[model samples]
Target: PGVTRDRRYGMVDWPGWRFRIVDTGGLDPSAHGILGAMRTQTLRAVEEADVLVLVVDAAEGLTGVDRDVVALLRRSGKPVVLAVNKVDSAQRESALAEVFALGFEDVFAVSAGHGRGMGELLDRVVELLGPTARATSDADADADSVDADSEQADPTGEKSEVVSSGAAADANEDPVTDLALDGEAGDDDDAADADDHADGDDADNDNGHVAGNATDVDTAAAEAAEIKRFRRPEGPIRIAFVGKPNVGKSSLVNRLLGEDRVLVHDMPGTTRDPIDTPFSVGGKDFVLVDTAGLRRRRSVDTLTEAVAGKMARDQLARCDVAVLVIDAAGGATVEDAKIAGMIEESGRGAILILNKKDKVPKSQINSKIDETKEVLSFLSWAPILLTSAVTGAGVAELPIAAARVFEQASRRISTGEVNRFLEGILADKPPPAGPNGRHVRLYFATQAQICPPTFVFSANHPTAVPVSYRRFLSNQIRQAYGFQGTPIRIVLREHRKKRKSAPPERN
Candidate 1:
């Protein structure tokens, strides 16, 4: 076991076996003081795993940290499988001599990078695991399911707990959110209700015959209930400018906001903490988060940016959309690709902003854009807009694009349209056949939620649909109804079989 600041996962799938094993190295606390936070997060992920496999280095034989990990795992009471790695390279039967001293009954000598001795190691580990491990895994999965459900805003009249939490956090951070969406309508509605009360036909007249207005009262109540769905307040659309250092993120923020809200400097890592500014344009409100430039995790331990980078990612995760501002002259660097991957993984709507457009020559501008797109092929769906934040050229379009992406993200499809669209897709090219030689059938699809409109699909062989087929379906959906600037998730489920009808009430 060794200490790694970032998490990593490995999978072992032995074909013909019904079970799978996910292996993660033991959580050895980071040497850096600030990186100590990772140990807590590591414990959380490890605790959720079905089984814990601690791979020890045979070259190092046994380390003091390895003993600490064993002690910690024992206290956690999680079933720990120890595999002494690098045995073949160590190439001696005596490689695990020190490891054997620890006396874990299920220990085995193996090489993790290669396939040496893994089968025996896994077989013994599986024998140690009883049915209870799977049960515990499912229980943990259910709890996570409940947590995800709780985080969503309910469309009914009840206010979601997340809604209240977001509101409080937003109010504490920026007062401009108060002017965003929630309060703007209530005052007008209350005034109109007051005037209606003042009229002579008021229902408050005690023991009076208000028979003619009874329908109006009922209708108003019904209308109010319907309006509540649309009236629910959403926090200001959070837009984050994310990229490597010295990419003009702060400068872009100032250009759009008409003020130097954050510091600008020629040197790298000038801005250390994330700065947020709330503003509205043409009555559309947004919260702009300008985060510190992120460096590689290994290099960030001593830099003040160590903590800032984490905060930046946290901000990026909560944003409604992200503006990836990269240097046009620099092209897409490795750090830029990492940031783009983060945007996709976060499922945020993105607009790729190629800043410093003025420095690039006119003849090679299109080629540069093409090269950037090729570099970030995974984000090809995201709209790319060229601009120079310094000169304010084409800068005004950022907000308008943000508004459009948000609108598209929040759009919902009717059940009829979804089913109709699915019908055409299936008729054109059916789902591929399963391995059992049975034809896969996509029974139906429905939109379960909006704002990154998620769809749930029912299929006869849900597990058999290949990734290629899913991608084709997603592309077709995009073509039929545009979701250009947003990402949509598809969840699959087994179709419910119709129960055999009681042999008809015949007799």
Candidate 2:
């Protein structure tokens, strides 16, 4: 096997992330012992990694070999995250069980080929990895104090996890890690510890660390603090419509346009390059991208085909929401699930568009719908829209659905509204009791931020919020406010003000 240095690095132009991504070759013995060697190298990379991303073949469920790989990863003692690839159907949800069987509970079923599941996967990974903690050896801490001078200067002392990619122009430059991953980087216990260490450092300046370096650190910290405040202006929402060949994605696009804008062909994979067409949906301007069909790896024979497929997938990284078009008449296939999984993995909001429903029989259509629900069960919430490109059955509703999903994805609820909503919910049926007899009182709520709307609720005994109640609240939010086809996040925080209770005096 020929050896080549495939390592590349650079800054990702993400608003709140300094992404350092290492693209290593995968190891598949049958394909190439080169893959095996690559796996070894990749594993080493994983050790230095804040996150471990294992991309699986979605079409080929968790096979015996993939299981073996998972087993190996589990034993590695690293934070193992699974990405089930090529899942593009309503029937493929069952295949997820096979992946779960691999012992990775946190599995992301996605279609890398069609840009699915990429977003949430990254979000979770980043959350888990956190701002890359300085590889501070336990030895880095002196006695009871840690030299957290680096952190103190960091006003919002969130461990800066810089995600660098080898794919960029300048790899050596460490792009500034954003201040906070969460909405607000309040100084927590960890930050307090770092602050204490800083105080101790100032008290006993034995080494006399240079004033210039101190200023530089302070400046970097200041910059990091301000970085959190910097908000990139919002732009038009970019949507990518992707699926397997002859799935009516193009047809649907044409239907949406009410004109033959995209080249609609009877043949699969006719549209080689991803075509971008701008259109208005629910009064919101959107750029609809119609990518070439993404087929199975085995099905991809030619180099041109593979390249085109890659280009189609890369488009997912560029999109805010991805519409996965499935052939409803054909029934939800493993292919459709795989594609759905990809959209999910991309972390982009997804609306599973079941097109060509007019052709399918009633019984078959019902069965297909059930299967679609089953396969997409992993999704917290999303709409399965049945449409027909030939006949405008549900095409008009597609844009409205997309816009609604987008709105939900980017929505941030006001604190006042959340508190009022909480009051109403509690009055209807109070939260279950905690370990103590005291009932949990929700103090207030705030928009933690969006792209899958996240809400933070400050309450008494936040940890005691039952899973059932959380689900109930999630549903209520969706029903009252149109969360529609986007995922919603509900975070619980202990209200400090509620903790200090004093009798209210008559004023």
| Top-TM-score candidate index | 1
How do the residues 280-331 of candidate 1 rate in per-residue lDDT, one tens digit apiece? 8888877777887887887775545786788778877667889998899988
lDDT of 2 by residue, 202-235 (tens): 1212232111112222322332243222222355
Residue-level lDDT for 390 in candidate 2: 93
Please give the RMSD of candidate 2 to the true structure.
22.7
Clashing pairs in 1: none
Backbone Cα, N, C clashes tallied per candidate: 0, 52
lDDT of each: 0.61, 0.59
How does model 2 score by TM-score?
A: 0.47
Question: Which parts of model 2 have CA positions greater than 4 angstroms off?
Answer: 1-235, 258-260, 264-267, 280-284, 295-310, 345-347, 362-367, 424-443, 459-469, 493-507
Which numbered prediction scores highest in lDDT against the true structure? 1
lDDT of 1 at 439: 68
Model 2 per-residue lDDT at 82: 75
